[model samples]
Target: MDIKNVFQAKDVPEAINLLDQYGEAAKVIAGGTDIIIALRENHVKVSVLVDISSIKELKEIKTSDDWVEMGAAVTFTEVMDYFKGHKEYSGLIEAASLVGSPQIRNAATIGGNICNASPAADFVPPLLALDAVLTVEGKEGKREVRLEDFLLDKGRVDLNKGELLTTIKFIRLRKGQTVTFSKLGLRKALAISRLSTAVYLEIDDDEKCAEVRVASGSIGKHGLRERVAEESLKGKNLDKAAIDEASKVLSNEVEKRLAGRSSCEFKKDAVEGIFLKAVEKAMVHNGDGSYCAMGTQYYPRAAGKE
Candidate 1:
């Protein structure tokens, strides 16, 4: 990696101005967890590096009555700490905790993960399931973009030369709503996901599904919503049979999307278990006792228990 100049912007506006001045020659570095590797691998070349990790305004997390707003520079550790023991959003906390290891989590920013836009990024699916919106600031002005639309393709985003992602905001999970994540990786910890699922579900008093949002990573060109699977469960009672059917729907969707890829067969089968696990977790956290008895047999026991 060769860099002619390195500028540490003290604030968001200064960062935008620096980006505008350097144009495409400048690359933003927050935590440098992904950008450093890309630079060393020669995947990205730039004449200037603008470090925004020190910007205080970009590192805070705030919550309103309806939404939670996380600064672009907020670390995974910060996210984990904020949501610790909060069952409604446990899936997101789990995702953040599972990104890399302790050191990496301490340094990796949520904005960096989204901007990296890797198909296998662990955080993307959960955020997508939650319907996240991004606040991007540029020299011209500030604009908001949906997380799904901001991700254009593998390693590509909708951001322009002078823009900087400032914050990620999402609707807070409310009563009767639960979001959960399940990942199938090569190893238990610090492994890149082979297949993963995130589910957001809400059930009405009658036990019929009111809202369902399903998203997956490493099973498509980018992290995407599984509408077919979601449609299969919407307005239905999320029983074991319904979960099984939805899992199959997700598997078939994966098979169709990756028909000829070498990992298709494995992924097709793997997604069934992953999707079911995500749904089951979401149901368990639904807080209504609706699904408590549906799948209790499969729940993992405590460390000392049989």
Candidate 2:
């Protein structure tokens, strides 16, 4: 890797100033799990690496009465720890746990996972399902954008020169609402996701699907919302039949999007099962018509436990 300077930023303003000064040659480095590899492989050319990993403001995870705000430099391990037993945020925890491996999770920031914009990033689909919003800062000012809109294409986001993603914010999950994630990989541990799905479900008092969001990974140019599948489930009782129909809808959509790709044939069929798993994981019910059970397991392997 060819590099000229390294700046250790103390705060968001300092990082923004360094990036503005260095322009396109400067790249933010948090965790360095992804950027370091990119630099080594010549995938990216950088003259400056602004280390924001130690910035206090960038490592915060704050929650309000109705929302949660996480700094861009917050690591996956931190995410998992903060939301560990919170059933409503189980999907977010599961996704964080499933990233690369324990070491990678400790060193991999959610912001980096997001900024890297990998098609198979474990944390993205769950965040998308939550309709998360991003707060970006630059020399000019700060601006917010929906996560769905911020993602443009494979390995791309709407981030501009001199701008740094500050925090990701989303509404807190409440009664009757839960998010769940499921994925397929070559092996249980240390394998990148081959396909994944996240479901944000809201079942009303009548046991009908009130609102549902389905997001997918490794099935498109980037993580995407499966609106057709969501539409099929809304207003319907979440019976096996309803879920199966939604799964079929997702299967069809995957076939359409991945039409000419070599993995299309397999993914189209496989997505149905994966989507169902995520939906089922979020469907735990209670007598008060609320989602009461956190249908996720804490994987010891992900926690670096033998």
Candidate 3:
């Protein structure tokens, strides 16, 4: 790491000022899970590091009647703890809990996970499914951008030179609405996702799908909404046939998008199972306590990693 200066910011304003002063030469670091590796490998060139991990405002998790917001520095362990017993956030909990080993989860921040913009980022698919919004603050002002729009491409976001991603917000899951996530990895412990899917589902009084949003990871340049599959499920009963139809749509889209890649054949086939799992998990949350099959069973436990 060829870093010269490291600025420990106490708050958002201070962090922004540091970033404004250093511009492209400065990098905002919270967990250092990704950036540390990038800097060591010379993938990122920066002379100064602006640390925001200790900022109180960046570590807060706020909830309201209609929304849930989490600060940029909140770790995955923090996410698991705060939303542990809440069934509406089971998808988020599952994603956060499955990130790397426990030690890595303790240090990995949600903001870093999103900003790093890896195609296989676990939390991103779930956030995308929830239609989360990001708050970015800079010298100019604070502005909100939809999570999908904020992500420009792999390893890229809309954050400007002086801006920092402050918070991520999404509508609270109401009755009949839930989000679920599933991923295929080589092993259960410290396994990076080969493919993943997240489903946000709402079933109406008529037993029909009121709304459905599907997002996927590792099957594209970045986490992306499977809109065609979503369209297939909306307004239809979330029965075996509907889910199967949607899975087929998702698989076909994957095939088309990854036609020239060597992993295309495998991913196009593998995505069906992963998508099915995510949607089924979302549908099973019909007020039953059995919403999350894994219910707080964090991975990489004493039991062998499988």
Candidate 4:
């Protein structure tokens, strides 16, 4: 596909107008990360490039009221900077810092990451664990959907033809809650994740599991919640054995779904470690639990090794 025209939209309304005028052949480009790749590979048949990167409303990161809302254009770099002094959001902030190295993170938008719907998208798992909500604007008006549902499958989303992702909002975790993010990229940097996991567990003062959510990526066709695993830890005691069982359920769940995928076995093993680590971290931060008490040992391998 040849680049015939590039349309720059000043705001969400203008962007929607471009989409309406261009119809199916129009493609929206924000950071140009995915669209550029698509254009190079001839994967898209786009005539009008509706660039929304200049939209001011989509670039701000606002935290107030009941949720922390991010504009669709918020970059990974922005996310990391937004949470620098905040500890409760450390997990998601860390995930943002770890995604796609410095350049890619600087250019990649959080909305693009969600809309691209990659199974191994680094931030999807964390936002899922956060139980995020996305507000989308269309010709009719706006609609809000849970992040888990908005991101349905790989290379797919729930957006309508002219619906532009506007804002992403989620509850800001309270001061004693625990949240953690982990990923299993093949390398430390410049590598797509082979798998990733994020856990947010709110352990009460009595040391009982109050609220727990687990999400995984790259272990299936799309990142999804470990429902069975979440159910297993509900209202349970904070102990090594209980955490072990929940971790086992998560591993088994992913293995069941991505069974024949080439990376299933590797991801299964990786999930065990990631899940255990996330839970251990959460417990230590919020519960009266310790990694040493979890009866696990992690030996540092040689360089260029696991």
Candidate 5:
């Protein structure tokens, strides 16, 4: 498990060249967050280490007409700094702020998070909820993959030999759109998650839900969207009864995948509580329930009040 070779690239072109030379025997290290973890566990063996942390092009944040494109090497700390004031990315900004600690956040990049492909990766649920896509470049050239398709299993992605994650793209949240992210890790600080959920919805003038996205992690080997629960909640009225029914759907979907886990019974109750709180918090601006005590006008799903 020794890292016998280490090569640092000054830019993306150099990085790509190094990867091309080493091919499958190579692995890119940006933040070194996941790579270090795997190396410590003796789970990953990369003969050629191409360090991409020095690459300038893969560390930018750009916004287009419909989306915000995040460079592969942009750290979680950088995301927090850049998106704190951005109107469209409140949910993502908050999620980034919650990753690891100050040191870990300073070193963990979004691409590394996605490419690491951990089922309980804290960032994946919110990104999937935003319907995010990925751009990957390899010797054959570049191609885009939907995040759902890119992550097929634990520690698995569609990235080919000599390929590098280039960017992540997602539409900017618009007016009337609200999103919530929740996670239950073993501890509050520096913990891997046990279960997590992301809820994003756009509400119409008639108080009905539109474009609802619900995804979860730690229920299986990969972070996946629950299509059954999402489809069931789409176009439904935003009311007490509908919210309760939607939570029921979510609980069952989670139950279907919770067998043999260390915390199925606890997850069964926590999942329902978390989803209901997410929906209720998202609807607070709609004038239905008491505001959460967090002193922020925004919905706080972890508080779990209706």
Candidate 6:
């Protein structure tokens, strides 16, 4: 693939203008981590490259009273640094920390991860569990879409040829709410995830589950919410029995999704363990001592026990 032109935009408007001018003939490059490889392999044949990595506006991370907005170009290192030691959303920090190596983390942007739309993207499950929304910009204007909807399929997104992703936003988790992630990768570091789960749970004053959201990756076409599992856990005690039932629900969902594949049998059995691990981590962060040790009997603490 021979490059015809490389244009560097100074701001969002300029980037959108370049995209509009070139249409499908141009491609956007931020970190150049994924795009460069696509170009090398002839997967993407573009005559123009619009470089948005230098745009300061696209690299900002903003926090508000209700939500946090991360610019499209914000790197994984930036996100990890910003939320370091913040256990409420440690799932996101953990996922970001696991993306490739230190150099890759410094170069890979959250927007690029979402835009790539890989079935095994490390960041998708945690973001989905967080109910994140994406802000897309184009010549017409900017519009927002839920992260779940923005991902169309593997290697595909809702982004139009003349559009660029601007920001990702999600509501802040309040007290008694936490999201945690677990992944089974090919190796300890710099390995792609084979399967992963992210659990978001909120316990009420009575120690019953007030809200539950489960998202899984590398099991279906894209990262998806495990509604059946979530529904089963709602208003229920977060004890061993409830956790086991929820894990069974997730296993069934995975089996149904990958019925004919060779990996189905392995994944169906593995999902339960992974889901349980994610839930256990989430419970620990939420101050649940009953799940202090895995593979042990449940012992519910007295009321008001932290």
Tens-digit lDDT string for candidate 1 (24-136): 89999998999999999999999899999999999999888999999999999999999887788877898888888899999999999999999999999999999999999
Q: Cα lDDT of model 2 overall?
A: 0.88
- Please write out the lDDT profile of model 2 over residues 15-100, one tens digit for every residue: 99999999989999999998999999999999999999999998999999999999999999999999988888889999999888
**3 versus 5: better lDDT goes to:** 3
Q: Is candidate 3 or candidate 5 better by TM-score?
A: 3
In candidate 2, what residue range of length 10 has the lowest lDDT sum?
297-306
Over 4 Å off, model 5: 285-306
Best model number under TM-score: 6
Better of 1 and 4 by lDDT: 1
Q: Measured by C-alpha RMSD in angstroms, how accurate is candidate 2?
A: 6.2
Instruction: Itemize residue pairs with steric clashes in candidate 4.
Output: none
Residue by residue across 118-227, what tens digits does model 3's lDDT show? 99999999999999999999999999999999989999999889999999999987766788899999899999999999999876655577888899999887899999
Candidate 6 residue 41 Cα shift, in angstroms, is: 0.8
lDDT of 3 at 190: 94
In model 2, the runs with Cα more than 4 Å from the true position are: 285-306
TM-score of each: 0.93, 0.93, 0.92, 0.91, 0.90, 0.93
Overall local distance difference test of candidate 3: 0.88
Clashing pairs in 3: none
Report the Cα lDDT for residue 268, model 6: 95
User: Model 6 over residues 1-306: C-alpha lDDT tens digits?
Assistant: 789999999999999999999988999998888889999999989999999888898899888989988899999999999988778888999899988999999999998888988899989999999899999999889899999999898899999888999999988877677888999888988888899999888777566788888999999888888899999999997778889999998899889989899999999999999899899887643354343211111235432253
